[model samples]
Target: MKFAQPLWNDLKCQLQDGFILDTSWTNIYLPNAQILGIGKDITAHKQSKQVLNTQIEQEKLMRNIA
Candidate 1:
């Protein structure tokens, strides 16, 4: 039996509603030339991180002004 190694990747997808979707995907290849993939949504996590980063930058600016 021959099998391709499994791989993982992070992808970004854009929706018609103008929302960005972050996904982590895992791909597995089978001996019969079939491939299977699984994806998990991480939009909320990414958005939260962006908010936190902005907050941190604002705090830094305020500190510099002090």
Candidate 2:
């Protein structure tokens, strides 16, 4: 099955945040006909990390207040 544009866009965003994107393909007719690909987007990964860190800090603050 082919991936949708929205899904692809999301994947790209994640990649930009420094997350890694991996894909694999295999042929049914040939067991040995397999392919794999992997990539990383440093900018996205960094952004994602920052967002996660901010969320964690917020949660910690809330817990301390409670």
Which one wins on lDDT? 1
Q: How high is each candidate's TM-score?
A: 0.64, 0.39
Cα shift from native, residue 56, model 2 (Å): 0.2
TM-score of 1: 0.64
**Candidate 1's error at 19, in angstroms?**
3.9
lDDT of 2 by residue, 1-66 (tens): 553322222233334678555433232332356533333445556578889999999999999999
TM-score between candidate 2 and the true structure: 0.39
Q: Estimate, for each residue in 7-39, the C-alpha lDDT of model 1 and write its tens digit.
A: 768899888998888988997766678877888
What's the CA error at residue 5 for candidate 1, in Å? 11
After TM-score superposition, the amount by which residue 59's alpha carbon in candidate 1 deviates from its true location, in angstroms, is 0.7
Off by over 4 Å in 2: 1-41
| Ten contiguous residues minimizing lDDT sum, candidate 1 | 1-10
**Total clashes for model 1:** 0
The pairs that clash in candidate 2 are: 16-43, 16-44, 16-45, 17-44, 17-45, 18-44, 18-45
